[model samples]
Target: MKRMTTLWSYLLTLLLAVTVSAAQESSAQSLLRSEAPTSLRADKTLSGFGYADRNETKFNYIGTKKDLGSFLSEYIKLPDVGVNKITKISFPANKADAGNSYIIILSEDGNETLYQQKCSIIEGINEIELTKPFVTESGKRYLVGFATKPLGIDDKDFAVLPFDYGSDIEGTSYYASSIVPYPSEDNDTFTLKSPKGLGSACIFVTLEEETRLQTLAYIINVSGTFDPAETGKDITTRFTVRNIGVTDITSFDLTYQFGTGEVKTIPYSLKTKLKSGKTGYYAFDIPAEGDALGAVHFAVAKVNGETNFFANRCLDLPFRIGDTEANAIPRETVLIERFTAEWCTFCPGADPFVNAAVKSLSDAGLRVSYVGHHLDDPFAQPESSQISSYFQGNGIPAMAINRVPQGQTSLLMHPSNFQAAYWTSKLLAEKRGVRIDKIEQTITGDKLQVVVSGVAFQRTFDPENLYLTVILTEDNVAAIKQVNGGANYKHDALPRLFLTDALGDLLSPAADGSFTMTLEGTLDAKWKREQCKVVAFAHDNLKSSLMSRRNVYTAESTYLGVSLANEPVALGQAPVVSAEDGYLSIVGDVDCFELYDMSGALVTTTVWTRLDPGVYVIRIFSNLRAYTSKVIVR
Candidate 1:
C-alpha cells in the first residue's frame, strides 16, 4: 500500500511539472509575437497597409467596429466611403510557393461566412487584398488573425487576445491571432472595406518608435535681359523661391550673394497647418544700386519646437551698362562745306551721297561739321555772296573741304572717295602745325562767342598767301527749287555767315612762326544749336585760281581733324543709249560710274570698266565726291 501511494505521488508531480513547462512556452511565444516588426500607416487608406516583420505565421487585422469607434475619437477622423472601400484583392503570381495559403472569414454575432480566397506571397512583402462586398450591421464587429497551428474544433481557443496598438486603449477590446508555428520574421499587407457613409481608418502596426520626421527643401530660378546701350545699369543676381514640399516651411529666408560683397536677405511667413503638398512664390529683385556679381542662397526652416533647416546655393549674373563717351567720339573734328545754289540744275543729284558720307562718318565716332553755302539761293546772305566771291567762281555745285577747294575741279564725284580723302587728310593733319588748341563755344542771347586758338609750327611750308576763313553752317533746312536736272532739291548745312581773314590779312610776308586766333559771331534762333557747326581753315590764297590752278594744296578737315587733298574730277551725265553693234557704250567725260541693283544696293561701285548685258541702276559721283547720278546699266 505504501509503495503504490509513493508512485501515485511521483506521477502527480510529473504531470504538474509538465503543465507548468507548457504554460511557460506559450507565454514566451506570445511575447515574441508581440515584439514583431511593423510600419507606419500610409495616407492612402484603400491601398492596403504594409508592415515589416520576421514572424512567418502572422495575420494582419482591420480595426473592428468597436475599435474603429475608439480610433475615431482618439486619433483622426474617418475617410470617405469611395476612398475607404477595398475594390479587389491581387497578389503576385510568381510568389505562389512562399506560404500564401489562407482563408477570409467574416463573423457578425453568431453568423460566420468563410471565404476560400487564395494568395501567392513571395519571401518579401506580400499583399493580400479582400473584397468584403457585404456590409456589417451597426453593432457587429470584425477582426483578422493568423493561426500558428491549424484551428481547433472548439471555439474557446479562438477567443480575442491582448495586443499593443502602440498606445494605451480605453474602450477598445484586446485582439490577437492564434499561435501558428512558423518563422519569426515576415512582411505582409492587408486591405479592408466599410460602408459608404462610414469613413475608413488607417492602421499602423509598428513595433518600434519613429526616428525621422518628413523633410523638404526647394530651389528657385530667374532670368531676364539688360541692355547697356539702353540702360546704364547691371543686375547683380536674381532668384525665386517657393515652399515646394509636403511639410509647412516656416520662417523661410532667401539670401542673394552676388560676387563677393553683394548680398540681400528677405524673410517670409508660411502656412501653419501645412499639409503634405502646397506651393507659394517668392520673388526678389536686385536693387538697382547693388554689386553685379554675386551668388544667391536659399534657406528654409520649420518654426516648430526646434529650427529644422534646409539650404541651396546658386551663382551670380553679370551684365553691361550704356555706351561710353569714347565710343561716341573716336576721332578728332573735321569741317565740311557744301557749296550749292537754288538755281543749280544738277546740285540735287549730289546731295544724297554727301549726306550719306557725313552720316556714316558721324556714326563711326568721327566728329564732322558741314555747311551748305547757297549762292543765288533765295536763302543766300551777303556773307554767302562774299564767300562765293572769295573763291572767284560762280559755280553752282561747289564744296570746300576744310576751306580748301577740292582740286579746283568743276566735276561732281561719288561721296565715298570724298569720304576716304577726308579721313586721310584728318589723320595726316593731326601732326601738322596749324593746330587748334581749344575751341570754347557759348551762346548768350543772339551772340555766339567762339574762342579758337590756332598755333603754327616753328617751320612753315611755302612762302605764299595764307588766309584763315571762318564759316557758320546750319542744318535741317528745306527749300523748293525747279532745277533743270530735276526739281525738289532738299539741302542741309546751309551757310548763314562767313568771315574773311578772321585771323589776319594773309601770310603775304612769308613769316615762319606760330600764331593764335579767336573768332566770334552772332546767330539767330532760325538756326538750331544742336545742328550747327563752325568750320575754320587756313590756306594759300595766292595758289588758288579758277583755270590754271592745277596744283591744289587744300586739306580736308573734319570737326575732329584734317585730311590731305584729293584731286576732284567732274562725273559726266548718263548718255542716251542706242541699240547699235549689240553693245552699249558710255559717252562724254564719264570718268567713273557705279551700278546698283533695283533695290538701290550697290552691286559694282568701281570705275565703269565693263558693262554687262543686263538692266541696272548706274550711280555717277564726281571725282570731287560732290555730285552723283543714277542711270540704267543695260
Candidate 2:
C-alpha cells in the first residue's frame, strides 16, 4: 500500500511540472504585427487580390504591366530580443481555391533572398508552421511576401496575400517580377513597381520570444540636407528612434556608415526616459565629403545597455546635395486639369465647384489656370485622349491638381474635392526645387517657337527623369452641343495641340541648374491666334513613384503673342460674366463686352435675332484680369 501511494505521488508531481513549463512558454510568446496592414486594408471592402484567366501559361497580374509575373510583398518589423524565432505565418485565402503558397523573405534592397518556404494552402485563413524557423538580425528590414502557383489540374486560381516591410513607410505596396522565387534579377523585362489602387497583402508572421530583458529601440527615420556647401564638413544627420519594447528606455548605442564605408559607433544617453511605443529624436553628423550619390545606413545597436534587444536600422537612399547657387523655386501657379464630356449630364454638376475653386484660389493672391480635357466631345482632340489615358481614371467631371495624385492610386478625383487638393498640392510644390522662371514665345511666319527656361535645382546629380511639357490650349471654342450646359456651350482651355509628346520632352539641366528647351510647331489655321495660350511645366516621370503620385514641380503659362520682355500684369478679382438664355450679363468694374461667333466674326449688335441656336463667345475686356475670360452663350 505504501509503494502504491509513493508511485502515484511521483506521477502527479511530474504532470504538474510539465504543465508549469507549458504555461511559461505560452507567456513568453507574443504576437508581433507589421504596420503594412493599416495602409493595405485602408479599404475595408477589399478582401483579397487575384485573377482567373483562361490562358494558364500566360501569367496575369495587375498594376502597370500586362505580361510580367508579379510578386507582391509586404514589410515586417520585429522587436529586439536575443532569442527571436519566427515560428509560423498566416494569410487570408479564398476557400474556393487551393494551391502551393510561398513565403518569401528578401533583403532591404530587394536584390537578394534571405529565406523562402513553400507550403500547401487550404481554404479561408491558412496558418502554416515553418518546418525550419529563421532568426532575424537587429537593425535590418525584411520584405515578407506570399506567392502561389497551381498545384494540380483542379486548382484553377492562385493568390496569396501581400506582404510589405513598409520600407520608408510611404504608404506604398510593392510588386517585383525580377526578384527570386519568380524570375532572375537580370530579367530587365520586369521592373519593380508599386501598383495603384491595390493595397497591402495582409500577411501575419508569428514570433516566439525568449528573454526577460526589456527596453528596445528602433531607428524610424534618417534625414539630412544634401547641400554642397556642407562638403568636407560634418553635416547634421537627424535620426528618429522609437522605443518598441515594453519598458521605457534611457539610453542606446547607435552605429552608422556611409556607402559601405567604415562603421562608427556612438553611445547616447537621453535626457528623459523614452516610454514604451514612444519615439525619441536625435541628431548625428556624417562627413559630407564622399561620393555625391551615396546613401547612409544607420542602426540602433544596443538599447538600455543591453545587446540582446532587437531594433530596426534604416538605410537612407541616395540624395542630391545640390551644388547650384540657384535658390529653390517658389510656387507660382497651380495647374488644374478637368476631365469632362459634353455627353455626360452629371459633368455640369462639378462645374460650380471647379469654377468657385479657381476664382477663390486666384483671389487669394495665387495664380491658377484651368484646362479642360473634353473626352468624346465635339471639341475633343487626340492629345486630350493621351493625357486622359495617362491619368487612367474612369468617369467624367474628374479633376487633377498639378497632375499630382490626391490619393494612393489616381491623379483624378471628384470635382467637389478640388479646393482641398489645391492646398495640399500647393504645399508639395513649395518643397520642390524645380521652377519655371519664364516662358518665351515668338511667332515666326506660320510656326510658333517656344523657349522654356527654368532652374531645376539638380547640379551634382543628373535630372534624367525630369521633362518639360508644353501644351497649346485654346479658349472660347464655339459651336458645341452640351448636355447639362444648356443647348450650346463654348469650351474653354481645350487642348488643341501638344507641341511635345503627350508626356513631355526630356530635360537636360546645365551645370549651374539652368535648363532650356525649344519646341516649334506650325499653328493650325482653325485655332484662333488671339485665344490660344502656351503652357509649360517641369515634372518627374518615374514609374515607381507614379504609383502614388506624379510630382509636378512647377508650371507657368503665356499667351501666344506674349514675350519675355512683357511685364507680368498684376490682376485683381475676375469679372463676373455670365451668358445664359441668349442674354449677356457683365458684373465687374471697367469691363466692356464684345461678342464673337464661331467664324471669328465680331458682333456689334444688341439684337437677339443674330444669335442662333449655336455656341457664342462673349469676350469681356477688363484691366483687373491678365487675360479676360470668354463667356458661353446658347
Candidate 2 residues 1-634, lDDT tens each? Answer: 0112233233222322222222233322211111222222222221111111111111112111122244434433333334466677666543223433466666655566777876665544456677788787765655555555422221122233332222222112334443353444442332333332223234555666534335556675677765343556777888877655556788898887654467778898999998654567888776665544334567888888887244344545344443433455556557778898877878877878887776655444345656788776677877787667567565677888777776666788888865645574555356556777567788877888888887777432235467778888888877466776875567777887788887778887877887888888888888998888787777766332333325577666656766432123234555565656766665666455555442223554353434444434444446643333344455
Q: CA lDDT of 438 in candidate 1?
A: 41
**lDDT of candidate 2 vs native?**
0.56
Alpha-carbon shift of residue 159 in model 2 (angstroms): 16
Q: Candidate 2: which stretches are off by over 4 Å? A: 1-326, 389-394, 420-432, 458-462, 542-549, 565-634
Candidate 1 per-residue lDDT over residues 1-634, each given as its tens digit = 0112232233222222222222244421221111212332222222221111111223222111221111101111111112123223221111123332442333422123333344433322334545343232333333332211212122112111112222111112111221221134121111111211111111221111111223333343454443231342434434433332324455555555433344556564554543322333444554433312112233443323323333433422332233222212122444555666667666776676676656554443334556666665587866665545455443546554444344454322334346655655554444333444344466678776655544443323222344555666655566766375344435566666663442223533224454445556677767765555555555444333322221122222222111111122243333433323323355544455555332222456554345444334443434344223324333
Highest TM-score: which candidate?
2
Q: Provide the lDDT at 168 for model 2.
A: 25
The regions of model 1 sitting more than 4 angstroms off are 1-334, 359-367, 389-394, 402-431, 462-464, 480-490, 499-514, 542-634
Model 1 is weakest, by summed lDDT over 10 consecutive residues, at 70-79
lDDT of 2 at 55: 13
